[model samples]
Target chain A: MKTTFSLALAGMLLSTTAALADTTITIESWRNDDLTVWQQKIIPAFEKEHPDIKVKFVPSAPTEYNAALNSKLDAGTAGDLITCRPFDASLALFKKGQLADLSDMKIMSNFSDVAKAAWQTDDAKHTFCVPMASVIHGFIYNKDAFKDVGIDAAPKTVDEFYADLDKIKKDGSYTPLDMGTHDQWEAATMGYENIGPTYWDGEKGRKAVIAGTEKLTDPQFVEPFKQLVKWTDYMGDGYKAQTYPDSQNLFTLGRAAIYPAGSWEISVFEKQADFKMGAFPPPVQKAGDQCYISDQPDHALGLNAASKHKDAAMTFLKWVGSQEFAQIYGNALPGFFPLTKEKVTIKDPLANEFLSWRQSCKPTMRYTYQILSRGTPNLENALWAASANVMNKTETPEQAAEELQKGLASWYEPQQK
Target chain B: MAQDRKPVRWHVGVFLAPAVIVYTAIMIVPLFATLDLSLYEVRDKVAAFVGLGNFAKLFGDPNWSGQFWNALWNNTWFFVVNMAVQNPIGIGLAALLSSNRLRFAAAYRTAIFVPTILSFVIVGFVWKLILSPLWGIAPDLLKSVGLRHWFAPWLGDPHTALTTIALISVWQFIGIPMMLIYAALLSIPEEVIEAAEMDGITGMSQFWRIKLPLILPSIGIISILTFVGNFNAFDLIYVAQGALAGPDFSTDILGTFLYRTFFGFQLQLGDPNMGATIATVMFAIILVGVCVYLFGIQRRLRRYQF
Candidate 1:
């Protein structure tokens, strides 16, 4: 009887010892492609800072991430820290109280107002996540293509932009715009998002449209749709079949003159591009019109509300928002312009070129996010379809605008319940 | 007196139990669960029972019905293309390979079956590249044949995209029917062929009169399999054209549409209820097709015992 009792006591002690030694903090992210940075740099640096807590990086493919995260969240099996998207998707999680309230975190104070606002709940009192990176959207052009075509500078106006495209066309050697409309989202990202924000420059204007006080089919919105169609003319023959990676390769290989893409692509282009790469904001409608570059925060890290290791998760979140984190992010992941407001100067020339736009142009989130924050889902896909329709001449600009308004109505009516 | 008693056969029940349990758990349970989910509506992130509301919206609502009809029609076309193109070519190849004196028959059969072993993602990407007008070897090959002008962006054109995808799918899967029919053709008795040869019946005449009739049942099975597969095909289209199934959703099939509705693509939030509705509809479609094949088509095709 004494031996059995002693055996039970020993088993309990062994289990407790194992449990005490295993203080792991798991963080989930969709950026599996950047596993090298996470495994080799970020997690190692984090573990060094807190030797007691071991960081485990959980990853999913980007295409499957949201569904996987949502399933895990529903099952109450999500990781301690989850990388979330901004606006509606994050807002939904925040509403469900799935994310821990990070409003009281002192580290959040260092973040830019845009970053803070992006991850904030509808109440505006509580924010769930710490915004890590803001992607700058603009055209990354070949400087050699500009010089060969005898164009001195990146066009500041719509007229000059068209003129330069014509010169590049006249040069007869390169495709003016390297665009892959095959994915459909690429056009909406590089074309509509870039052009639409310039027309709908202010937040009030965007909010008014989403609120139904202003119409999406209005002339202001219609004009941007027209501009998107015009951009397609510059995307060479059989451009409809060209894919996103194919378009990027065309630009890097010097087959095309200009490539409109997000700042995230800078690191990739730097490694592949042969010639000098330059970037500028999408040219404005008229000569004097102020342009807005599409700037939205990405990979907002949130602590799961149900996490067992809340203190450890919070420690990591704080570390993620620190200046040291920004330095590592900017240096290792060069494309993303860090939103931490720290003076981490990214040495990549393409990154510098994209950053130059932030100095001169107004910053706007992707056009659909304004509508999406109001709880409209699939608005980006609708706009993507509309852009494709206008480009393919399947629908006129007016028709496409009407369709956009119709699609928004579907979301609006459903939400009214 | 002991010899008059019969032995108990408890092993039959024991052997069948595992399969029945597995099938019920994996297939039957999920199928019914999805059907049940179709009767609910998700609002504000909560699911509430809505009865026939989802079905009404699917068939009655213009926005929903338009996409539904397009997918149904596209799925029908996919099946029809496989039947009309894939099966015929497969049969022709199988017939040639089954010829008694044919050279390198094993090598030819292996070569034909190679693509069937490839994953949908690999095939989709490979075909997309081959059909791409830019950075593709197709244009140069066409030019070499003095048919450069005939080379257009077939996969990018809405009118051609669905057909192109169908053809690519057929190319990947034709080996399945070919092998099945080849096996069926080989099962023909040597005495029948020898007897036909004695009557001066040979080649096309012999094949048409004897082999074709014998293989009708295999062909029938292949058609049903193709119907089921075509309706369920999602991966290839998703990998190639993505969730939008563009060139303006020309390549949108039932599987892709169901996926988009359920999982939500891009800015869309996944609606499990609506997704379940689509699954229910797809189940009904597959059920009807299978029932018709089993009761109507398969019943008519006589499988002659070798």
Candidate 2:
């Protein structure tokens, strides 16, 4: 009996010591192709820095991310640190007291005010996340394809842009603008993220719409959507049949002149495209209009309020905003535009070109699904459907615009009470 | 009477308890719970009772009815296509394979059944690539046959997208009906065929008069199964077209609609109550279909002992 008791005590002591030696901090994020790089390079560097804490990443596909996160958070089975988009989804969690307040952290000093404000809760006081990166939404074009079509330079005005498209269309050798609306979201992505700012008069107009003070069907918004329909001609007959990946391949293979895509695609383009690639801001509304790029923060890291390892998780969150982590991020996936105020040089030329928009042009807020409230008709979804309807000639621009207004009203009017 | 009376069969209840408990826990309980939730609306993360408001919105409100009706019609079209194309083709293949004189019958049967065993993801992606105009073999094959001009992007066009997906589903699942019908054909006694032969009914006539009638019950069974399966279908369309059911939402179906509502997409928040409402509606649809078959059709279709 004494021997058994002694053995039990020894086993307990060994297990306790092993547990004390390493603390695991779990992070939840959407699965990306860069995940392998993150696992190999990022996690190891962090582990090396803090020997007492081990980090593990939990990932779900983009489609499944929100649903999986919601269930996990509700069940209190979520990771120590969670990845969420800025504004609403994170704000919802914050309101429910699911996230820890990070306003007092010294590490947050690395972020710009704009970056910090993007993830702030409603009171604009406490922050729930460390902003990681922001992507510039714009057009990715084949520089060589433009030259082949006898176009010497990227368009600076709306008419010049249309003229370039016509030139490529007249050449009859390649598709002018490569986009596949088969998945349907691409149309909205192009409309709202890439081109909407140019017509909505940039960030101020967007803030107005989000504030519900300005209507979506106003003349300013309507004009851009009307202009949006003209590109249907350049998309070719297979545009409806075209999937996003198909367009990517078309652009990469030099089969298309220009592709409207986000900065996130830079890494893939650099690896795949054999020809010279360049990026340009969506053309200005008139000859003298200053160009703007939709700069938006991506997945931000937040601490789970229910986490057992609160100290370890906080330590990891602080390290995330550090320059060491930024260097690791730059080396592993240079395409992502880092959000830190520190000077981190990127080596990828295409990435640099996309970032150049930051220097030369005004930065505007990008459209996010987060603006639409939960449990209401989604304005973003309605806009996507309406845009597709316009392209298909099923709905006039007026009708589509009205439909959006109605959807917004459905959500907005109810909340007024 | 006292001698004939058996003691209470407590063992029978004991034997049935596990299955009943499991079924009640997993299926019946969830089903009832979903039905109960349909009458509520979730606002700001709290569920408030709204009665038939969701259903009214689904059927009557302009914002939702368009999508709801589109999905319903598409689902109906999907069911019709399967019944019209999948069943007849399955019957024909089954009849051919059941022939006693046919050589390598087992191999042919196995070859035809291969696609049924494949998952929806594999089938969706494979068909997507095969039908893709960019890097697909389809356009090339058509060109070789001098039918290149006839080739169109079937999956991309709003008019043909749902039909194309349905036909692809038919191609993958045709083996199910074929196998079931084949089994039914084989179960026919040799004496019955011999007797029919003696009566001068041979080959096509013999099949029409004898074999086809024997398999009516099986055909009815296959039809109802196809209905339920098609109405509840989701994965194929999702893997192929995504939740938007794009090219102007031409391929939207009830299953996808339910999924989009329940889980939410893009900016829309997930509403469990509304999802429950959609599920309850789906249950009613399936229940009505099953009842009509059970009472209206099956009662008249004879399952002959011979």
Candidate 3:
């Protein structure tokens, strides 16, 4: 009896020691292709230095990522670290006391002016999400395709843009544009995000409108609508039937001349063999419209409130935002063009040019439909899904616009009161 | 029998307790809760009972109404496609594979069923890769067949997108009907077949006239199963086309619509109340289908001794 009791006591002590040794923190981020880097570089560096901490990184698959994050959040145990888009639910999650205020995490000092401002909340006091990366995604046209049609560059005015598109269509070796609407996010790119600079006129006015200082149907938005339709006309027969990536490939492999894509794709395109792709901002329209880039924090990381290992989670977040981590990612194999101020030398020439263009832009906002449309709950559902109807000619652009406004009215009118 | 069983209400309560508790907690309670949510409007991030307000917006508001109808119509077509294409194909395959002395029958069954074991996301991704014009096997296969012209990017084409996805779904689930009908066919004995032969029936006519009648019950079961599965389908569509079901929402189903509404994607804000309303709509739809089968169809199809 004595021996058995002693053995039991010894086992208990050993288990307790083991438990103490592992300060496991599950950190959630969208899946990174550089997972081996995380394991080899970040995990070891942090774990060895911290000694008392062990971090378990759980990456969400593309399809499972957001929904899984929200469900985990609702369950009150979404790991110690969570990955979420900067949106109403995440904002609400912050407001509902489910997230830690990382306001004091000295990581704020390293952020660039625009990056910091983009992440700042309504009050501008708390940063609910630590910035992972940001990109200025806008319309990109192929230079070679444009040159073949005897156009030197993408037009800077609405009239010239239309004339150029007409010329390209007349030449007709390939389509000038691919509407590729099968992927819903691509529909969002064409239907909504692309319209920002043209419609709202500029950065300051656009920000004001999203802040509810401007009406949904400002006179400024109409011309852009016309310009938007003109771009659609450049698409070949059955334009709405194609997927976004398909459209990109067509432009890349010399099938189509123009693809309205974001800067995130520059790195990917640079790797394509035998094809030299170049991008400039969407053409200016109606005299005042300069090029526009939608500047949403592509994805952000949040600290889970209910994590058992909060300290370790915070440590991981700090590491992810550090200059060293940024350097590793920025210089990785098939690397990233980080939206950070880490100043890592970009190896891809295309990425360097795109980043330079994004940096020099005088006017921009963190995307409108993604930000402004959130005034109505599940507004993207109606707006993005409504694009299908628009393509089928079942719903007119005016009808799509009205549906968007009505969704907002229903959602926000009550809340406003 | 001895004393009228004393009409034991207490015994009835004891017997019913476990099931009632389980059902209430799992299904009934959640259903009522979701319905209650539909009646309430979200206020200041909290819910207040608003009484048919959500439904009014859904039906009366143009934006909400259009989507509600679009998803409803799309969902209906999905079911129709399954019934028209999936059911007949399943029935045919089951009939063919159920024949006596079919060598490698088990191997064929396992091979055909392998897709059903895969998660919907996996199935969607694999099919997306296979169908993708970029790296998909379809374009190459077409080129190899001297019919490369036929490859016009099936998945990206809105006209063909939903049909393609439906066919993929059918490919995955054809096994369900195959298994059930195969079981039912196996149960109809050699003695019965011999007796039918004695009655001047044989071969193909024997299958159509005699064997098929005996398997009517299994067919009914398969139909109802298809209805429920079709109504609840979401993951594959969501994977192939994000929540928006793009190329113009041609593939948008009730499940994807509900998911989009409940868990806002991109710029959309999520509304749990409306999500619940959609869920309630789906429940009512499934319930009607089951009821139609139980009350209307099942009653007329009399069970046979064979």
- The ten-residue window of minimal lDDT in model 3 chain A covers A330-339
RMSD of each: 3.7, 3.6, 6.1
lDDT of 1 by residue, A128-235 (tens): 898888888888889998998899999888898899999998888999988867878787777777777787774555666666776778787888779877878888
Q: Report every candidate's CA lDDT.
A: 0.84, 0.83, 0.71
Clashes in model 2: which pairs? none
lDDT of 1 by residue, B174-195 (tens): 9999999999999899998899
Top candidate when judged by DockQ against the true structure: 2
Model 3, span B1-306: residue lDDT tens: 878666657988999999999999999888899988889887886779889889898878766677789888888888888888887887788888988768888898899878989898899888887877655788789889898778765665667888888888998888888888889998888898999899989889999998899999999999999999999999889878777776666788899889977876654556788888888888988999999999999999978784
What is the DockQ (computed on Cα atoms) for candidate 1? 0.49
Instruction: Give the Cα error of residue B210 in candidate 3, in Å.
Output: 2.7
Number of backbone collisions per candidate:
1, 0, 5
Q: Who is ahead in DockQ, 1 or 3?
A: 1
lDDT of 2 by residue, B1-306 (tens): 899999999999999999999999999999899989999886776778888998997788776788888888999999999999999999999999999889999999999999999999999999888888877778889999999887777887789999999999999999999999999999999999999999999999988999999999999999999999999999999999888776677899999888888877755656677778788888899999999999999999987886
- Model 1: lDDT of residue A183: 77
